[model samples]
Target: MSYRWLKWLILWIPTVVIGLWEYVRHAFLLPYVSMELGNWLAPVFVFLITLTLVRRLFAKLEAMQDSLKRQQVVKAAFEEREQLARELHDGISQSLFMLSVKLNKLDRAQSEADATKAMEGVRHTVRHVYEDVRQSISNLQNALQPADSTWLQSIHRLSSELEQAQGIAVTVDSKLYDGLLTNRQKVELLAILREALMNVQKHAGASAVTIQAEHHGALNVPVPAFSCVIEDDGKGATEEELQELGKYGIRMMRERAKAMGWKLNIGPSALGGIRIEITGGGASG
Candidate 1:
């Protein structure tokens, strides 16, 4: 039966049984049965209906709920896969296209200095593409990694990677509870953090980077919001570079923040380099 029909049947069965019993007791049994005996039998009727029909109906409803939950899990997995595909297309694919363009420039260079500049551009594009792919792979691995691996651990891993690969010092100071973020939020936030650090390694010329996250509102209550900051001590960007910051990877970070209903701000850090701030509503999901 349809769900609505099941509900209607469950609701009416008790009433119908009680009404029929009452009618029979008054119309026919009054002559043969005592009032006390009819009153005692009423509870038996209710107990039998609840034990048999109502219990079965409840079981079916529970089964349907479980099936729906399973379907939702499958749907969420598909959605995550789709998101990964989009990230690859927007990031790595674009970098590859840029790499091809740089190659064309290198091929057409007419002078030694021109060829050298073009070669540098080609190298930069190749390095950017490599970082993009490596970051994507690391993110996927983190997703499939054991649940014992916490989000903070992922952050530290990313920091460690940067420090080892680029010889830059990375420090993390996080106060926001992990329970405050959903898994999807944590993933997006991590990607954003990774992109920010890559930008530092590529262009910031910094020696040290700091990542800080702070929770807002009371500890035991619902947090209204939180903020995470990635800052570095390096040569800051010029106005022209700041204006072009939204071109590639930084644009992806902005899109990720927008998807999460968050704000991303880029500015000069007090420590001498750039600062990236991501602010969003606190989470319980």
Candidate 2:
């Protein structure tokens, strides 16, 4: 019950009992002793008790209201951070992409000696700035929203971009089960694949590139997992190149696999190039 109702009931109970007692004593037993001072003090005592109870209740209510306001402020701050991240990714990121493309085009134009040297310096600066902006946008976007690309889709898009932009022939084959990979895993795999493919295009000088994906079951084995293998037939790596790959593409692939709790294998391809294999699934996957 409310404090107000409880307080009133407590004050009324004694008054009712005393009034009945006085009536019975006067009518059947003896005349009741009455005091004007006691009558005046009864209301004073009740008033003091009621005031004390009300003051405590109000203090508790004000504390609860303050707590709620603090929580609301925290919620608002979190929402603002998310909104700022989104704006940076969607707006500033696109502008940087456009700027990078224009700088690349300017760098490609044949020019006089002095002009070429000046453009080279500009290009170098622009490239560094582009890298920084891209990384910042990627970090912010990752924090604000879940990745939208699937493992298969990320690979497909990267392949298409490389082919269109760099004249590399790329193909994909897969029987991917949709929604079978987490967003973080998908993005990491895509980054590894892009690095591997870029190495092939820039150094391998291969005329054609092929990508294939198939389900590999590890039933009755020590570790049960699904496997994905990517192979390319191109200029094979030298021993020195193989060693350096650990500092380059192989390291990226390993980190991505580790993050997803996967086992990764990198070796020479049967067709005389490189082969990368990864196996695992995240909890959501």
Candidate 3:
């Protein structure tokens, strides 16, 4: 039954039934029914009503809730598929088109110098396409996997990707506890971290990068505040340079943090490169 029907069943049914019973007992059966017998009959009436109606109604409600949860899961699956389709179209498809154009140019070159330049362009475009494809596959894999995967595992995966793609060294020092971030929080935090690392890969020109995360309050606390820092030992950005090359990624990260009501900071790192820090409260999902 619907919630309103259930509510009426729970509230008004019992009140109306008991009121009618009491009225009959007092007005019509008072000469035959003793007060003690009436008192005992009242509980018996309530018991019969509960056993015959309330129990079945509650079972139906539970079943309805379960069915709703299943539908939500199916809806979420469809949405994920749609998102993957868009990513393929926007990223991998465009990169493949560029790769095809470069191949055409390579094939039409007239001179040795022109051919060599075109070949180099083709190679660059091919590499770009490969990276885009790899990233899409990784994202799809992550989406299909279970939510129990920890932030450390995600960071390690990103580190592996950065190392493979950019030949950069990555070190991770995470002191934040697992099982303390909601799924939404994990997604947002990972997106911010991924963007920050991508900026380092594209602009830092550094050999090594470090990701450090730690809880902010007492270690023994059940739910503590936390912070994450991503930095590199590369040629650091002056404010002006950040405004030029790293602006898009930095702004995206800042927007994510703001959406989550967290704090995001960008500044020069002690490692002589850019530092991106995120701080927020931590609680179990």
Candidate 4:
């Protein structure tokens, strides 16, 4: 069945044939035999058995290596999930609780107020706080969820949220096809994009941003690659600043691209802002 068993069979077949021939010769031609001939075959059979046992032991080692790889993947995913959960609970949950307290105080104050006008103001304030909390929770959940769609769709959703949160105009022109990237590539790209946008929110006083995707020729004939570019219209970073901050966000982008055998470009935009571009080709689904 297995290669090891086949090997043993091959080794023993010659010995079996020789034994059969010797028996036929003794019975018919020679009409004489010795037990010592039979005793010599026993050592060869024992050696073949030892070889088969060693092959089985190596097969077990290969199985253990496969198991270790699977365990490592599972552990990494679990750690990511836990980190997201802690962020949500510590940051957004605390903000919501504070808002709730303020709302409760306002409700009590309104009960003692002079009429319909006070009630309307209280209701409006409550509604705004509720909407803000809802949106904050939604964004946190979106960031934590596993990416299950096209790269284009994921970037589009991310841009839309940034537009709403920061009051900036965001646009996306993605042409990446669905199901063309491996799962690991998709996840790493998503993290890179998120980190880039976070840098924009923290440092760039940008009023507008745009993202685009294009296809290019691959190294080999008839193969194609995909590229994505994200640009912003904000005050561009100083060369020194770029060099410093690049160590974290931009470096991450580069490493992820390298791991996938892709290309990543990051620099100042022509419109006095920053741009990040990523490219990869011949990716299997």
Candidate 5:
């Protein structure tokens, strides 16, 4: 019940009880009303009023506590963003600048061997910058991973970051989101998608990638299953190559899916590259 209703009931209790008592005295129980009765009931009335005030006080305190928790979450997020900014400037920005200078030097080199050496330096710098970014993400996530973010919002952020970093076009279509999965499920799903995107950046030479996700019901199916597909238009893996030791990233992604009791499929997509599909059967928490 609402606090307001409780307050009203508490405030009226003494009057209601005393009036009923007086009515009973006149109608069936007692000979007549006594003026001293009001004095006797005064203590009970005071008690009810006191109890109402205490109830309101506790309710206000609880509301304030909730407000404080929300503010703390906001403050933590701000600090994490500030830390991320410092790392980006110190790491990624500097690396990209050096990579640009190396590319310029490669173009101006007269010897083919000199140009090849410069190109290798450029590739090494790029890899270092990517690793630096992923490490930064891990650090920041550990320190202040916001539980309130929706999966759709997380996907948008990830897709934008990959597009900017790899210069690959990314398209995302989602009809299922917030209510279809619990926070833990969303975290797992995002980890899987991020792994897939990393593979695309490192291996897929395609110009575009597409991600589709949904959670829908079917008459024959007892529960709606959460499902997502990531596909790219780059060279895909052969069935034999999929089992190679070098494909450890794919194995890790599969392990995550298996842990969640989800199916993980790796195969050719219509887009002409690889398609990764993950599906979970169960009701969302």
Candidate 6:
């Protein structure tokens, strides 16, 4: 059954049936059944219905969690494929272009020694390209493996990729404030982090990046708040540039924050790089 249908069946059916029974008792069976008996039976019926509903809800939730895990695996595979595509386009394609120019030089060489040296240069370029392909493949293989942690797993992987592939230093500091986040919150927050990191990797040219997260709340609030900050040491963007077309995924980030009713700020960090800070409502998402 659909969740809504099952919920109505489990929670309301008993109450409705019992209410009808009570009405019938007063109308026609008043002498046959005691008021005390109906009183005791109402609680009993409600308790039984609630128990059944709780069990069914938990089972459905478990199944949904398993399905989400499978989806995550598929997403990882697609992400790795994208990574391979970028590596091929950026690294191997450029190398091949350079190699072709060298090949032209080899064809027009002056003498045997020059030809030999040209051949050696070609071999060197070919070997480097081969190693680059091998590394990309290995990275893809490793990235497709299952994760055994929370949503922070992807964040850690992103940081590691930046450090290893781009030679940038990254540090991630995340904590569950009063508690963990819902699946919706995790997904949105992960997207925000990825976009922020991508902007740094593509444009910041910062030597170091730091990601910090926390969940906290005020004294009167019943739910904990969610917040994160991404800071880098790269060149920061100007206010004028931020309004221009297609600048550092700024529009996408702003839209995401708006959809979630989050307060987002983008500006220069103390280290002269861009800083992105996000704060959202208590029990966000």
- Which number leads on TM-score? 3
lDDT of 5 by residue, 180-228 (tens): 5766577767877876876787567778999999985652454458789
Looking at model 1, residue 213 earns an lDDT score of: 95
For lDDT, the strongest prediction is 1
TM-scores vs. true structure, each candidate: 0.62, 0.45, 0.65, 0.54, 0.54, 0.57
lDDT of 6: 0.72
The TM-score ranking, best first, is 3, 1, 6, 5, 4, 2
lDDT of 2 by residue, 1-285 (tens): 554665666567556655765565457645343456445555665556557764565666666668878986696467446544543443345556756766676667677765576567666556645544554454345444445746566667667755754576777887554455445555555656665675564456565677776544533443334566667677777667865643444555676578668777777788677777776653312
Q: Which consecutive 10 residues in model 2 have the weakest lDDT in total?
A: 215-224
Candidate 6 has what TM-score?
Answer: 0.57
Candidate 4 per-residue lDDT, tens place, 1-285, comes to 554655666567557766766667567755354557655655665566547754565566567667878996786677456535543453345446665665566556644654455556556555544544554465467656675777777887778777766777888777665556566667777766765775575467899888787666553433357777878888878768865643455555676678778878778897679988887775721
Better of 1 and 6 by TM-score: 1
Residue 140, model 5: lDDT of 61
Ranking by lDDT: 1, 3, 5, 6, 4, 2
Where is model 4 more than 4 Å wrong at Cα? 1-69, 72-75, 78-140, 218-224, 245-247, 282-285
lDDT of 3 by residue, 51-142 (tens): 88877887887787899889978966875675566556655677789888888888899999999999898888778767767766776776
Clashing pairs in 6: none
| Alpha-carbon deviation at 99 in model 1, angstroms | 3.5
lDDT of 1 by residue, 1-285 (tens): 777887888899888988999999999999988999999898899889989999899888788878988997796577557556755776678788988998898899999999999999988888877876776676677656554457789889889988876799999999867887766677778878877887787678899999999888765655458899999999988757965643456776888899888999988899999989999885631
| Model 2 / residue 55 / CA error / Å | 26
The candidate, 2 or 4, that scores higher on lDDT is 4
User: In order, how many clashes per candidate?
Assistant: 0, 0, 0, 0, 0, 0
Clashes of 2: 0
RMSD for all candidates, in order, please: 6.0, 15.8, 5.7, 10.2, 9.5, 6.7
